[model samples]
Target: MPIQPQAAKYKPESPILSLGEKIGDPVHAADFPKAILRFRNDRWAEAVGLDHLNDDQWVQHFGRFQPLEGTLQQPLALRYHGHQFRVYNPDIGDGRGFLFAQLRDHAGRLLDLGTKGSGQTPYSRFGDGRLTLKGGVREILATEMLEALGVNSSKTFSLVETGEDLIRGDEPSPTRSSVLVRLSHSHIRIGTFQRIALEQNSELMTRLVDYCLTNLLQPAPEGVAPPIALMRQAVENTAELAASFMVAGFVHGVLNSDNINITGESFDYGPWRFTPHWEPGFTAAYFDQTGLYAFGRQAEAIHWDVAQLAVSLRLLCEAEPLIAELEHFPALYQDSLITHFFRRIGLTPGEREASLQFIESCVQAMAQTGTEIDRFFFDWRCGDPRSPARYAGEAWDKVRMEAAAFLPAGTRDHPYWTDDAPCSMHIEEVEALWSAIADRDDWEPLNQKVEAIRRMGEAHQPRLT
Candidate 1:
């Protein structure tokens, strides 16, 4: 909106420009019927030096999509292809969203501000490029909850209610519309590589690999091929992501290769649900009849998606090296799962084998007794530093003794730890909150829920690393 805005804290960037036009399309944002600023992520906005905008400016930039100073002169709707439900599709890309801007965050990490329902691009094939207000709300909740549980998730940057009526087969007709923006480390998807490799463009793939190594990841260690280092990083990052989802009891609902980011941050929420208990086959999307991306199979699904990345990387280097790094996913996931569980309960990891057995026993107890997963984590925070007594006849008895050997962790002194119940976002709770906004236009419940989630995050002292 401004050629050179007022003094800002973070530096502006357009690093994606270096990749050239092959990566995306230069596009314009749709002029909305109305620009109603429904949500503003001040916490993260300030980090990216965007908190300087007032309400009107916020709507003008995010809702109307004006070019931000020192960032992209225009929006870029990116291009890529992916496997949707294991069926490879080559025609899809950023149909509804585009990379709007980029900047450094408070932590000095490069961040991209991308949008959903901003407008239609050449990629918007066979469908309207609009996000329902309900979809926007759900994404906000999903990201907030996942972040609180220590998952590496994109922050829901902004949501602007665009006054438009849209008809959809999935939900009732004449639903409201909105634009959602997400702050993420990268918009580079595994599908991006698929598109490049599918073209047999090894040179292009090499350029991308170098780009990721320079910006998305730390420099490759001496004597290591960039492709090999990328495989190792993606594998470990993806394993940690899957493990966090398991520990948080989150069901992403969609595990397509296009949905998976090369940086391993989870975004693009749709038909997501939080499980009530440890149901291994619990499905989040109603259409997932096969339970391919079910609660328990998430790790396996992510591992498969990473394998596709390996196939793409085959263009750049020998498959042997990629396969070698890919082979580490299972063990990396196990370690990540145990590490996340221990962090959830405010305990340090002790023996690797012991931690593994302890987490499994806890899961077994959850499945058999039907304890709400969130409550279990909340109740057990800082569980007796001394060896907890074994239950006379309980599944968690062995787990209790095993956890006792690990020291307590985290700043769990928040009053939230003493509450009668934990802050949880099961599907029912989500629907009830949405009901108020849909029926009476009351947003208080949604506001309060976000605050509660934040408090829970503070209690856990979530580690972004």
Candidate 2:
């Protein structure tokens, strides 16, 4: 076999240097696999400002950055059709997004550096091709928070505060828009193949499968089960993704085939949420009225989404084999759940029958009596041997009281718990203040919480064998 150029000179970077290079400099700071987009404005600027190019200088900026040194910067528009809310929307292709380049990081790992909100293309259709600044800001937060929460997520590269006026609802007025650039392993989605399948374009689908296997899933060796084998690999990827989301308490909000990826990594961030409580019914999408994408139903949603991807592949193969591959979801989810359940209780290494029973007890306790999810963990972090036992009194009253600071008082279950509910007004005010931390637009509070969570993660049992 021929050797690849970069691999020939491969020298593993010390983990410290690998991580340090991402912190570029003061003008720009890199966050691990992704970096921050320097803020600019032109709706879709001619330059990424990597060289600090002004508007007129962007054309020079464009050609020079064409193929970033280590990432795949191919400029081919990918094909895909998807069911948007159960209706066939067969006309999606990168739309306004493009994979600009791929590069290897200091870690010697190849990562894709793609830009979204970069403006229009042949697939732009009838849209502004501009992303709202608020959405851009939210995506940055979602990626940062989810990474800290230990989910396999796309890292935010640069959030260019492109100083262009754009109009959108959910905002007080027309606001300055932005172009968000992200870095990841791959941007290939299940919908990418789904598009070719819907066209009955098997040749294209085969090429797509080959491309993925060569680049992302080359584990099966050179001459494995052919293109169809990739279909099986894709199934496994989706299953693992569903399990990860379950463990992380993440609600993807949109499970459309196009939003799902063959690699099983969480890619797009939209209407997503990290649960504050363990309620199975919690939904991040205000519009997910059908409950198909609720917190508890995420695994099933992923299964259904993957099945839709299989439909495209089935045009050239039997359904039973693909369906069998899809069945791994439940078992995978169960194993992942039990493992996480133990960690939440601070138990690890040993797997006794009693451990399972204890986990079941905790789940039942939380279910029987509605408990604040974040508070349950916060109480565990209280550093008191008596902390867990306090929940035994007054039917879990102490747990509720300790959690009181974290939940909205009005949301408490008192018949008189109105806006004017009577209590130690000072305590009520304090709770209101701290609870609002989750709703803040600024990063100071969330940043502090992230640091604390990181400290906790450092002390946890190793996640891998």
Candidate 3:
């Protein structure tokens, strides 16, 4: 058994915890007088102030979603391996996190609600599974911010400031620790399946595949063989995810196999950021010196990760079918990227090819000019093409001039292409900062932009070609 020695230690406790209880059905908001847990003058300690929480309080705050009908919430440690920076590190696993169990959300979606800083498990090899407050805040921002941007991502359901003190080597001495509860489709990753595949445990692999298919994918035809179908489905989901990241200016920071999910939703917001400028070599990870997972290389990185999954599955079946599915990645990602990019600029399917070409050219020019990424699109939502030309401040006029020269010959005819009127927003350097699009915080302006863009999207036509 190649399974890590401690792998078998993790198993769900008695009276399996269901997802329903965790979400707190018949949900009642906690009242001010209820005397709820509070972060001691600090949120990190107050959120998970389990010591202060009585049995009833725990039930009230976390009980409805607890799934288990008891005092102990037994966390299960998972086993898996991953390739960090293109190098295989079999010693890896949850090493820290645990699946609290699945939860059915208000929408009747089976969401896996897990905690990153719950506690140390067998896989916590030399490191604390505890999460810092900084990480907690970042994850919250990611979930709320990215969702508003129309990107599919794991949501931060709750941040229980575990009320405990932690010592993280990265930050200031004695970093505050808190539990970040994330709600997602499933916590299982490509690494989970890979582990079984590596062991050549076809039986376990088959069971795992079936589980993923039934839980992650929809009802399949009765007679269809699931393993191969599961692989194909994984390819499609992963490809779509890759495309979303590519078009959204998101660099996942880490594309490790353990981080990839069968559900294809973007989860685990670690060191993630929208590229500030269009440097193909820009990466979110501090340690990513070679930029293996750079902004422009995300598509390729994901494809490479998927290819690893494909090879791992080779033990159970021929490689050709898997290769075929993998081969479809580029096109799938391209279509997704184009769709997202079109939406960003309010392009619909009915738009003429020339119009789109103009938009693409404008985007390239803005990015090349090192313009902020988010504000540019947000400004475009108001139907301004030559808006950049009206910018009044220093250095901006130069960029505006460049934009004009970059515009295609007939772009002036477009309704948004202004010649006479200046850009409506103030011409301050702060305003200039917004024009580049990337500088605007992903949380702000993005939600408003999504709504306004949707309206334009209604009238908009996309590329017929």
Candidate 4:
């Protein structure tokens, strides 16, 4: 069946407006010669009250940055300073994107409709602000795979192929262009606060802190300062996010402060890759020569970014409390890793020590056999008896026994689990998907891949709470 967009049913709200001067800059999207709607996440749109928008309306709102009714009149290109690769750069903000609107999900949680490749902004530096069609397609694949794996991630709400030929030194010249809209919990990054701290604007900092606390974080204790409460929440959320990435076998190439959102949902899919094995030094981005954001160092990168958030919070609170909050990251990360690992493997939670040992054994098994990451999870899920005999060795035997006791009764009844191969998003597969689109204009492969991923997600019912 051909996909069609439905009417606009927008319910807009704007809490970030409290930042006033720090909110963003007014900007318009480029006047592309055409707006070809390539992807529309109707499921997620329904959750955010946008399921009714027809195709033309979808292109108008997402492709042209036309504000939704009752939302901000003009798109706001948010301003912030970030530490890119450990170097502070003040001239960084929404170079190619802006917050288009804010809305609430069915659960009443605030969500942001943010754009990428909308157009050049004050922070565009010296380059054209447009996203390559390949980049947009890659992001859709990344988000879909990550979400299927139960990682807290942003949804690629819309992807429109804008009519433009872009020249880039990285890829083939005259590549197609696109505009992408991502639906996330928040677009506010740690760098947002860093910018206020850098300017020594204590009053604005206080307002921002309070606003975040009121809008984003859960209610604080009776008398704790909002900054302290927010710090603790950010630490836990960031730690959990890192654990999700580790368990999902995902390496987010860039872990800059600007890329780390305070809300803890993973976004900004740049050079991301899924690990094929237990290789620690598997870096995603080609320029990450130092392996600073490697698969193994992902947790460290997140901790460093969270610490930077704490440093910014210091502008409004004492250092000791924030330091204490930072100290919680290791334990938080470990616990979350174990929990998420068990969830991914379809095992009920076990004793902390036992779970950690089981994870270690699984890693060793993968290393010794060189099995694909997702294949391991798929085969061993719920301790399925059909896993390779070699995987039933002494170490894995113990894990199987432990996991069997907790396996859900109807595990094998699911058609997805019975499949011979697991859904994987390795780089080769990603490139193949793109090649089909670029060379043959065949989108069927991408559509089929998404359907398979969705089925995999459905089979693993009740995603991590």
Candidate 5:
């Protein structure tokens, strides 16, 4: 099946250039010599006004490094420094990826079309800047599951299987190669600020802060400094994002500074996993030997990343104000957890204290019984009577009863409520899906899984009061 280009409606924008010298040399994607279009996110393309691109044009732009209509003439390989695991590393940037283009969605939010495994750049030190097909597939699955779970996450825009055999130490040798385009809110990361701070370029730091305040963030109140304002917004949004990850049972594997987008959206999905049994120590990355990014420690990890952001902002603002803003993360994260958890369970907003109690009781029950995280929500959604009562002790019973009172009347008879189980992206299921692709070159299973995840997303769409 050939991909057809859709009539593009929105024009591209390059606001990042406002921070001069922050971005690096121009780079072209690898001429993989083969372009096999494996996945195209038409639904998202429609939202971004690129649904009319034909297959050839799609390959030309995304695969062959040709510029999209009204987009960047040449991709920019962004430069930045990041702390891989609490250790600062200066030799890190878009080694295998670059910011291909930027455009606005229907709501006028700025979005970036960035590439992975596209080619090597100045940042591609001691590595063949390419992405494994398995890595691309895993990222698509991760983003799909996160979006369906109501987490603000990047969407896998397009995936092309570049016909090449690459050897990797992590997976089986001679694995297939691919190129991926991710549509994200912004490519600006915490490390972007870190890089400027490292250079002691306070002028550029101020410019970057101003750019983010004017473009990426909400308008600040009168008399509020842009750096302080940006830090506050980042704290709030990062807290909300961390809570969403918790409620979704996701472990991001690596919560490095570079991976933490300044807009607070979840991007750069690698070695991510959904919790199987709500275990706190569950880890996604095989290299995470110290459990620094374990399931339970995600909030801690994100808070650390935000603190690093505050450290960067100190170049433009006083440490006292920034420290005060950083102090808000703990409470904000707790409040957001309660809010997102309620939203996930399909319950109308309740008193803050009540919501907290409900979440605590549910967590206790799940921990005691080892209930599957997704299944617990699936069975107990809207206080369904058919849900397991074994773990519904007196405290949880009251919680459920209260939650039942807040269910929207419109959802009482929704057909999705009657489904036996919620759609889940467990590791075993992910392995099975990948096995079909690897063993027989069958893609039907992956397609079916994505459709099922989408249907579940539709089912979980919150009902209006």
Candidate 6:
């Protein structure tokens, strides 16, 4: 087995249960005709102390939802409510997924093993809980690409193709189905808090708030209220998430409260897309008719989403400090955007004013000159310390000249930097990759894409913020 062993041993815990019955209900995994393991993440498995399991053991635990030795005895289908594209839905939760297990990684940080297509619960409503195989594949691709690009995204821990044929309106009928397992910092979303606030359960809200501050963050400062401190941490995190997405050219299709993890890590990849260039109005989900969560508006969208989180927190404390924290989002996002933009282009933060001007100029240039997103960054890797110096010749010379003043932060020695073309994962290319899997059961293209993406990550040296 390929593994990246860490120093700390496996540690299991279920602190969410401390919130008790209000959060969720236990549910059994679906009975499938077959369980074929397609993807296994030994790197993360080792971190969580499951890398020792053989493939059969892996499928038994993940595919069949057998309880991990010391985790949740039964899967908990979490309950929460959220605004779906600005419309509130009180009856929305983990419809096709559930929290399967909770444990600490090698770094001693709490991580939840959640599912995407394991089965249905109270939230399934009118649909089958099965995830189409294509959807599973797409998620793997999305998470892999996002991680490679240095986005703090959920890890696609395992993907197993469960034998089943499901019908759907979105694509071809009777599509293949599968189950996906992901590892992330926390499953408690803003919607989770919103659900409590809706119930007007102040006691439970306080309990949940304490759970977050204790498990997700440190103790509140001497004078700081718990809600205010938690809100501040969340504000910084969500701002960083928005900045990472924008700089990576990612459009998260859905920016609902439920999809926003309170831990600030990006999760739930649906209707996601990478922009061809810097178009602020670009959208990922087709149903987003108003462009509420467009690429350019993501920072605003997250601010709005977190403000709702602050509203949820209002049930437990005074609104002034919470509102104050929400107000910090704009400055937090701009500073974070500038920070990540420099990291993305392999340069240091030269000077705040100069860096801001250069970034604005680059964004404007990319828009006016229609420069491809990855191409622009690829050409300037290590500020063209090596080959691939294909930046705009004269029109952008001043910007390039300014970039030269900053010391290089990323090395161009990786073989990937010498390639004729940058690693790209456009929708067109992804669909073509899926066609190969569907038509000929050829997995090489998808595998190759994952490898190439990892190589690109090696070249960029992605560091999670």
Q: Which residue segments of model 5 deviate by more than 4 Å?
A: 1-8, 388-414, 462-465
Per-prediction TM-score to the true structure, in the order listed? 0.96, 0.71, 0.70, 0.95, 0.95, 0.96
Per-residue lDDT over 44-96 for candidate 3, one digit per residue giving the tens place of the 0 to 100 score = 11222223445454434432335433322545556777777888777777655
Assess candidate 3 and give its lDDT.
0.56
Q: Of 2 and 3, which scores higher on lDDT? A: 3
What is the lDDT for 264 in model 1? 91
Per-residue lDDT tens digits for candidate 1, residues 13-51, read 998999889999999988889989889988787777888
What clash count goes with each model? 0, 18, 32, 4, 11, 0
Give the number of colliding residue pairs in candidate 6: 0
Candidate 4: segments with Cα more than 4 A from true spot: 1-9, 390-395, 401-410
| Best-to-worst ranking by TM-score | 6, 1, 4, 5, 2, 3
CA error at residue 454 for candidate 4, angstroms: 0.8
What is the C-alpha local distance difference test score of each model? Answer: 0.88, 0.54, 0.56, 0.85, 0.84, 0.86
After superposing candidate 1 on the true structure, give the runs of residues whose Cα lies further than 4 Å from its correct spot.
1-8, 385-392
TM-score of 2: 0.71
Worst 10 residues of 6 by lDDT: 1-10
- Model 6, residue 438: what's the lDDT? 95
Query: Which whole-number lDDT from 0 to 100 does residue 334 have in model 3?
Result: 62
Error of 2 at 415 (Å): 40
Candidate 6 has what TM-score?
0.96
Candidate 2 lDDT tens digits, 1-465: 000011223221111112122111111111122122333323112122133445334322232233443333234344566776666787776665666655444334445555666666556688666666666656765665455444556766656555567776655557656667675657778777676776686766666666677666655555545555776777666766676676566778898878887777777776777665566898888888898789888888778888887787786678876777677766665666655544433434134444445445555556666655544543443222124554675545543443333212111222321222111112233234334432553445434543444444343323331
Candidate 3 positional error at 5, Å: 42
On the 0 to 100 scale, the lDDT of residue 20 in model 4 is 87
Better of 1 and 5 by TM-score: 1
